[model samples]
Target chain A: MEEFEPKIVAFCCHYCAYSAADLAGSMRLQYPPNIRIVEMPCSGTIDHRVILDAFEKGADGVYVAGCMEGDCHFLKGNYRAKKRVNYVKKVLAEIGLESERLEFFNLSAAMGPRFAEIANEMTERIKKLGPSPLRRKGEEK
Target chain B: MIVAQQKPLEEIARLINDCQKVLLVGCAGCVTVCLAGGEKETEFLASALRIKRQLEGNPLETVTFTCTRQCDPEYLLPLDNLIGDVDAVVSLACGVGVQYIAERYPHKWVVPALDTKFAGGSLEQGVWAERCGLCGNCILHLTGGICPVIRCSKSILNGPCGGSQDGKCEIARDVDCAWQLIYDRMKALGKLERLMEIMPPKDWSTARDGGPRRAVREDVIIDA
Candidate 1:
């Protein structure tokens, strides 16, 4: 059987996570290429619909990375994002989907190695979970 | 505003289990503000239902629409054209909206996607707390703006009941005793004597005890 490669979508806050990913690249840190990063002005701007849409569009796992607690560029954007992520997790569980498929992470822009580590961690997690049940049969790449 | 929460996805999916196509109706009034139902929520629910049904091999099709306020008949007119094409309607509004849609499209099946919670206001960004009982009578003036009818666990009119302790209600420690709040407010206003006056028994007829109430303003009516 061929090894399953999961498609993971990461909504990265431009103020922190996105810049951290750039720094990781500059530092030559190695991480899984499975993660597709979609930059947002702030993690708070990523609504529940956008996250669910990623799953519907064939993402096996989704995560939002934002600034550390009490460090959101927009005052409390990360906090709001955390609350929203929890809400989506509950909704996913109610729909019979694994709540673990969605996650929220907080880190500083200077943590380039940590960003790469998260990429590898999320990728490995999704790989073990296999393709999302929502993914149509022929849609697998 | 009216607060509501969405029903579980599994329960909602079960409601329209056999339907091949369904229309999702969203309300832009109170439910929208409360985050239970709106254009975005309508789309989300439609997507979720489609995904669920597809996984089950039933493969449901959905059409989505949003009305300014479903309780008003005029706002529901847009559904007339689309109602004929769907087998069932899943309303993301409060219970009122569900019934309004059902009444507007009498022959269609209208399912409520939200459980209408209460007449309340947002406590914070994502938290809402009930504040009113909608008893069809106003008494906030006498109570220093505190509502005893709804805030009080026992709905006592005179004063705090035996259950009130340390400003909390007996029903729940977290619940603030309404009379305590009223007393504090009254004291701050130097109107403690207001509580001394004997109150009359509430008129139950003004509330839901009266069957299906209606309010009409003759001044606003123009004979057709």
Candidate 2:
């Protein structure tokens, strides 16, 4: 039997990480297919609910990918994203969910290989941690 | 403003456990301005709880309402209809708003959705830093608008102790020296002479030490 694959959601900022992921695909880089990409105008636009909803909807892991620090297209959108991500992590921990399920990453649009690396790394980490405890009803087990 | 943030989704869900109908109330006053409890947040929480309930095989109905100010009785009156029908009310307000709801509807269950922090202002667009202690006293004039009671970390009246180094606070490496900011601001305003004036130690009795402080004004009172 195949091992249970974690369903991961990647909230990518349109300015950088989304483009980087596309570049990774063009480069034919191998990464986990279980990851789903949601392109957002800026990582800052990613609401707290998006992270919670991902878990509520059976996602085993979620990660936000934004532009490198000080490189945000919207001045301090990435900084806001970082703060919200930290706040969400604390919220998850307080609610009995594994805080590690959510993560924030920064990289330039040119870092295609970096995107592939993160996909593989996050996939490995989630597989080790098992499925998200908040997975929708029957999705668990 | 009284800054606050929402409690964890699941924790909030558990708090209202067994309530089939929930009235998710948001405050449009301080909490809304701070982005802790507002209409958007109320919707977000209601939807999350709905999902959690569905997954647990227990159906739940959430009704969201935002009041001008949950801490005031007039604004709370609008929730009267919803309150009578819902199993519980989840207040996405500060500590004061939570208590206000409880006090107004003594028989209803009022649950807190956010953790009440302190009187502070945003350092940037989304970052909030403590700015005032609201020790029931006003000493900002003497401190050059820099609040020593709150921002100083030690709440020291005479600060920037010998422990201060390179403008950074000794107690915490990341915190800037509050007293230094006060000194600089006062000096820039040509009020350096005021620093020589000694301020007596703060009297705790005038604060929470007074046991539930109250204020009354005969001029503002109206009698039938």
lDDT (tens digit, per residue) of candidate 2 on B1-224: 99999887778988989899999999999888888899888877786677667656786898999999987799999898888888899999999999999999899998999999988888876688888787888899888988988888788897768877888898888898999888889889999999888889899877787788887899988898
Q: What TM-score does prediction 1 earn?
A: 0.93
Q: What is the lDDT of residue B53 in candidate 2?
A: 72
Measured by lDDT, the strongest candidate is: 1
For all candidates in order, the CA lDDT equals: 0.91, 0.87
Chain B TM-score (model 1 vs. true structure): 0.97
Q: Clashing residue pairs in candidate 1, if any?
A: none
Encode model 1's per-residue lDDT on A16-52: one tens digit a residue.
Answer: 9999999999999999889999999999998988888
Per-residue lDDT tens digits for candidate 2, residues A1-141, read 669888999999999999999999999998889889999999989888778878877888999999999999998999998988998787676555678988999998999999999999999999999877666546544
Residues B59-93, candidate 1, lDDT per residue (tens digit)?
89899999999989999999998888799999999
lDDT of 2 at B98: 92
Task: Name the regions of candidate 2 deviating beyond 4 angstroms.
Answer: A1-141
Lowest lDDT 10-mer window, candidate 1 chain B? B48-57
Q: For model 2, what is the C-alpha lDDT against the true structure? A: 0.87
